[model samples]
Target: MSKTLPPAPWTRRDDLARLVAALGIENVRWVGGAVRDTLLDIEVKDIDAATPLLPDEVMARCKEADIRTVPTGIDHGTITAILPTGPVEVTTLRKDVSTDGRRATVAFASEWRDDAARRDFTINALYAHPDTLEIEDYFGGIDDLAARRVRFIGDAHQRIREDHLRILRYFRFQARFGAELDETAEAACAELAETLKGLSRERVAMELLSLLSLPDPSETVARMHRLGVLPVVLPECCKKGVEALKASIETERRESEAPDPIRRLAALLPALRPVAETVAARLRLSRQQRERLTCAAERNEGDVADPRALAYTESRECAIDRLLLQGASTTPLRGWDIPQLPMKGGEIVQRGIATGPEVARTLRAVEARWIAEGFPDRQRVEAILQEFLQKRS
Candidate 1:
């Protein structure tokens, strides 16, 4: 079946075009994400070449061409070849010999048609030429891509059985490509979400985070919740966070700045009522992210009474905290900490204050005075602290 491509003239870097041309797609086609992103007019990442050449043969050909090839998953018939242009992933055509839902056992095949048949989605199954710019669609991927819809290549349940991660990818496709999902697709995703229970948290994290970092993350997550994918993956991700984030778009340009999974995950934290430790442990977040999210959520636990709270809870994440405060209270995210206290502990010592409870009391008084003074300069603060220390003494 013929499939429609995204637009005119797919773009390819010259060196990659030449390196890929060497392999020739006579038996295989360059396919998958590159083709999909090309259709969307977005820059492609990790170029993949589908070939009929066996993994071993592909390695041989690549070596003969003086191109570096990495057996990234040679056992699965996928080899990552390195060229001066960039890293090109070369995956052989394979049929899912068996699938445990959590993982699949694939036996490499020599036919692109059979290989395309084994893939999950029509959009993902389409292949294109980097040189001649010819698009090869075995399924209706071209039409679906045109319609901005995400439908499995064959039976939705069957595809989900092959790999449960496709369930999350269903939303990822929807968010990234603005694809409207069908009933069968949503059902399949919901049905397979339970299978995610047995899958690795790291894998689940990767897919969930990809969905969260998209342009329309809130919408995608809302859909995932409707499909019941939320509790299965990020259980705590729900309406409150979505609502808070919706109006706070200006809080931070997080989508562009902190584009990583951890930052996205952090943004979701303040929306929930769970404690930082609880959220961290449940999501199986990394130590660093767990701490960051915990801190961000804690900072949001109370009203921003003064800059001291901001300085204490959000010293590092001050920008995000400020935005949240401004959104919630119509206040500005910008606030200032009192200037550095000019007087040190020695100044108190020199003032002849006893080194016990009085010293601690005097320091507190000075800090309070500084904050009340609204962050005055070092000279003023020093003079004030000296006067206060003498009074307390």
Candidate 2:
């Protein structure tokens, strides 16, 4: 059975419509995530299409249509059509000729079923006509989508063996779509979990981050832990932290907080610098991400009884992350807000303190006194600076 999707923004784009018309609708069809997401009423981020047209033909058609084209993945039969709406990736239908547990050498085919069969999961194998909104489900993807089941298209182990990353992808898709784990898929993932080590850290991090970005990734992560998958990727994770992650996700929901991968990650590991450093290096985290994670862990170590002190020591954002992690652990959050210090460097300099390190030191002393005295008035601030100057003399 086939169902029609309502007119979505992507479906109604004039530029996309013109490009499809120029290419000849018979040779092209919308495919992949865009089609699947539209059916599920999820906002489609990218529009992907599959065609029987070869790469050269795809380029020639784009030329005739006056649409810009880039051979983003030409060797793999993909061409990026730059339309007014956005870049639409059009790949020629392909069939895998061989696989080496990581990547596949493919042969371009004219059959949509061939392409569908090569996909990782049935839900991802869905396609749709560019104009008619008619869906093409060679497998029982529509039924599986409705059932909220994430299953490998054919043989689970074979599919995973073709690309070890599929193991992580399985859990990620399950988390995002609120799909239950398929038993066969789980068994295959468990058996093949170690194969994830063969994959590049960047690939692993991308999948892991995507999984963490889900509304509530705690359940899926806990399942991953149970299946012995977590240790392979995040060796620092413990049962206690995994359990804390569940409570953290609930707190996020109750407080209407946005999904925060780093904060959730902190909840899933010990709040220690070494642990953060190890995970950051292993995952190739960005410098900013690493700093934030480390700072949050540092803040979590001590009593964050004063938000101002925390803000002075780390940052406001880091303070909030610490509070969230503390809340997750059922620890009381102190310091409602970060109060600004009522002193400045110029004031210290005017108090006859030398420039550079001395001025910085005097400023810190004055700010500490102010914070300790509940942020006193400017008169008191001047008096503190005067007293500090007298002591320096």
Candidate 3:
């Protein structure tokens, strides 16, 4: 008796079957996250296969089959097969020759176990034959998966040392899958936490945002703070920040909204625009992202009484962020299409106001009144403009 790959939509694809045929079904096995997720009944998004076929050979075979191929990560032995379904990566089995706590220099190997050994986690190293659907588990990945435990491949310390980004990845996977923490893995992560400094901020930001995007990452984030990991990466975050994250999660649940990582990241920082801006800059966030983070951090008490006004003033997104973090009702903002002010500066100018500063000031007065009156209709806006003009006269 042998373990079989679980049945799923991805397994029924004719294009995938053709891909396996092109590479010789016996030469390749579906590997990594696709195998891991499918077995767990998680919807598989990306498909990857491992083979002894060299990258060039993989490309040549696909070309003969009339399937296009991209030499994505060719030096790392990965070639992307463009299928009608989606791009699937076919990589040669590899063994690490050297690692610098950030990246690995690898040599292609013919053994599946060699490649599996180099992966970050046991659950991620499971493989399944394309034709037989029989699983090849060199480690106790199946048992670990059943237990909902996230464990490193070999020595936890050695695995983290091989790629320092694994420090953050450990918490992320644990947040997504683990029920009980693997103490050995946890200890290794705690000890090697400093090694995360060597990783690119972009890579760190990607992993952090991913973790936060999960349904609820408050507990995992608090654990990271306890283990001395969060401070090393984001010192701006404090105990209060973790508490704010908890509040934010509760509000998202209340509002029936999806988890927002950038908004959550804002919650995990002090409520100072400068602090949020600083963290945003350090994380290399985009201009829009930096603005959102800063906006979420700065709470105006006046806005709390009227979320729509805040939405009109700043943005619907920023208004939602403030409301959720403030433990206020996002109900007012939900499904409500933000409306534009019905009057413009040109409309004010037509009312005998001068073109320069006076027209701008009167237009602002009319817009403010319209917004304060709940984004009234065009007729009402005309009335508001008249009132402002009479007041100025």
Which model scores highest in lDDT?
Answer: 3
True-vs-predicted CA distance for residue 356, candidate 1, Å? 8.7
Write down the worst ten-residue block by lDDT for model 3: 1-10
Query: Per-residue CA lDDT of candidate 2, range 152-187, in tens?
Result: 999999998899999999999988875665898999
Name the top TM-score candidate: 3
lDDT of 1 at 226: 73
Best-first order by lDDT: 3, 2, 1
- lDDT string, candidate 3, 273-330, tens digits: 9999889989999899999999998976766899999998999989988988898888
The per-residue C-alpha lDDT of model 3 at residue 79 equals 95
- All models: lDDT? 0.69, 0.84, 0.90
What's model 2's lDDT at 32? Answer: 77
Steric clash pairs (candidate 3): none
Worst window of 10 by summed lDDT in candidate 2 = 328-337
Give the count of colliding residue pairs in each prediction.
0, 0, 0
Better of 1 and 3 by lDDT: 3
Model 3 misses residue 42 by how many Å? 1.0
Order of models, best TM-score first: 3, 2, 1
TM-score, candidate number 2:
0.92
